[model samples]
Structure formats: structure tokens, C-alpha cells
Target: MSEPHAGSCRCGLISAEASRAPFWTSYCHCRDCRKQTGAPVMAFVGFRDEDLTWHGEPRSWRAGGVERRFCGYCGSQIGYSDDRLPGEIYLALGFMDEPERYPPALHAFEARRLPFLHIADDLPRYSGFSVER
Candidate 1:
């Protein structure tokens, strides 16, 4: 197996590894995503759950069917999973060492994007989850 790509929380108290390349990458503008990240949008990279491994005990909670996990020490959002997208573990793009390696392919929940924020990219925009679009 090739060496896995690694990521850590802001304070380095939580870390994870992905043994395989991401299945999908996107920027999410859903209200839920914005609220959790404290940003106008959140970038995410998804991997099959089996390809991911966690190094620290991250705190987690389920909300609106999504299980959100984060570093307990620094409060950096680490990752999340939704039953609606089975078998996928989505990590915060900013946590990765080479986040630019996975630029967002599209914008999800464009309907909820903040009015003040503008994305210059010409990537496809979906009103909801890409699967639902």
C-alpha cells in the first residue's frame, strides 16, 4: 500500500490518515456547514470510510443525520459523515497538508451561499447535495 496522506487539527491534538485518494471534493455552502465551520463556506474531500484511520479520540455528535467530529482540544472541525452519503468520510480540506491537491470540483448547496461571498471559479453549482442535483 502507498503511504497515506495525513491531516491534523489546528492544535495537532487530533489527526487522521487516508490511504486512498479522495472520491470527491467540493465546497459546501449549506447553513449547517457554515454554522459548524464559522466560515461562509467549507471545503471538503471525501474518502471511503475504510480508507481512513483516526489517530486521536475526536469528539463527535449527530445532527440532522450527519455525524460531525472534531478535535477536543482546539475545536477545529475535522470531519463528518452522513447516512445520506454512505461509506464516505469527509474531511475538512484545510486540515490536509496539500489541500491544493484537491481543489473543489463543484459547489454544493449553492442556494444557501452567503450573499457577501463570491466564488470566482466556474465549477458546477448545485442547489443541494451533488447527488440530489
Candidate 2:
């Protein structure tokens, strides 16, 4: 059985619950992600959109064809949507209440990764999404 996972925004105004395991988890090093997260890379876990239930509507913005959603009150990034990947939602891994439970299995956009950011030697690395590799 999959473990139950729950999390909320910094201000607790927005919350979500997922009853199943994540479909996939990855670290994204794309320039856009670096800028959005203000970190070396952004970690994310993919889930079926229908499996997630939010407490309220979050503010959203479009970037590179993906709709990024965040808490309206705290501005904490929550997830993102892409029409090309119907039925799939990508949640920011850091937002999880226990983020350590979901370590990224792969690294994407390695070409754009920062020079000083060094990932562990184990996880698979790709220039872009694995689908494109």
C-alpha cells in the first residue's frame, strides 16, 4: 500500500493530500527552475492531478508553457501544470512536510546546472528530461 502524504503552505492557507506514492521524483537544474527556486536546483515529485486535493485555489503563473501555482498568502510555490502532460501535476518536493522522504532519483538539465552545485555521484543525470535522453 502507498503511504499517505500531506503538506501545506507556509501560512497554512493552502494544503493538499495525496494518498498514493509519487509517480516520479527529480531535481531540475534548468535556468528557469534555478531562478524560480533561488536554489541550485528544484526538486519535484510527480503525481496524478486528480489524486491531489487542495484546500483552496492558489495563484498561478505561466512560464515556458507550464502553469506554476503557489500559495496566495505566503507565496510558497506548491506545484505546476502542463497541458502537454495531461492528468499529471508536479509538486515542489521541498514543500512536503517531510521532504527527506522523497529524494530525487534523477537530475535534469545538467547542462544548465550551476558550476558550484555538486550533486551526489549516484543519481542519474541528464541534459534534459529523461524522455528527451
Candidate 3:
């Protein structure tokens, strides 16, 4: 079998792997995402929940209608899931072992994007979630 896409928490206390290709990749410009990831734009890779597996004790919490997971020891955000979008998992791109393999297909919450960060790409942009979601 091919090697799965994998990654770990900053301190390596938590790890995750995906056996299947991701469903979607996106850049989220929402303030909630920025606050959670401490970045102007947060890239995310989405996959079917069943295709992904997690290791170690990652703490989870709900905020803004999404359940976010993080390493309790290092406080590094690992990923998030939303009940509204069942059977799907979204991992933080920066935490991915091979992020270059996943490129942002669209921009989410574009209206909330920071002024200083300008991306010239012509990827679809939406004020909220893209129509695909």
C-alpha cells in the first residue's frame, strides 16, 4: 500500500494519518480560524473521517460550532470537525507531513481576509464556506 498522508503535533505527542486522498483543500480567512491558528490565513486539508486515524491523547473542545482538537501537552492545534459536515475531518495544513501535496482550491470567508495579505491566485473566493461545502 502507498504511504498515507501523516503528521504530528508540534512536540510530537500527537499523530495522525490519512489512508485516502483528501476531499478538499482550502484557505480559511475567518477570524475564528485566525484566532485559533494564530495566522492571517489558515490552510486546511479535508478528508473522510473514516479514512483518517489519530494517535495519542488529543484534547477536544467545541467553539463556533466546530470541535477542535489539540495536543494537551503542547497546545498545538491539530484539526477540527463540524457536526454540520458529518463524516469529514479537516486538518491544519501546517501540521501536515506533506502539505505541498495539498494545494488550496479555494478561499473561504474571503470577506474576513486581512488587508495586508494579498494572494494573486484566481482560486474561487467566498465570503463564507465555498459552494462545495
Question: Which candidate number would show the highest TM-score if scored against the true structure?
Answer: 3
Clashing pairs in 2: none
Per-residue alpha-carbon lDDT of candidate 3 for residues 52-108, written as tens digits (9 for 90 to 100): 788897899997678998899999988899888889889999889888989999999
| Local distance difference test values of all predictions, in order | 0.88, 0.83, 0.89
- What is the alpha-carbon lDDT for the whole of candidate 2? 0.83
> What tens-digit string does per-residue lDDT give for candidate 2 at 1-133?
3677877789989888887888889999988777777777899988888888778788999976789888989999887877778888889997788889998888888888889988766888898865331
Which candidate would rank higher by lDDT, 1 or 3?
3
How many clashing pairs in candidate 3?
0
Query: What is candidate 3's local distance difference test score?
Result: 0.89
In model 2, the worst 10-residue window by lDDT is: 124-133
Model 1 bad stretches (over 4 Å): 1-3
Q: By TM-score, is 1 or 3 better?
A: 3
| TM-score between model 2 and native | 0.92
Best of the two (1, 2) by lDDT: 1
User: Best-fitting candidate, measured by lDDT?
Assistant: 3
**Per-residue C-alpha lDDT of model 1 across residues 40-111, encoded as one tens digit per residue:** 999999889898887889999897788999888889898798988888888999888778788999999999
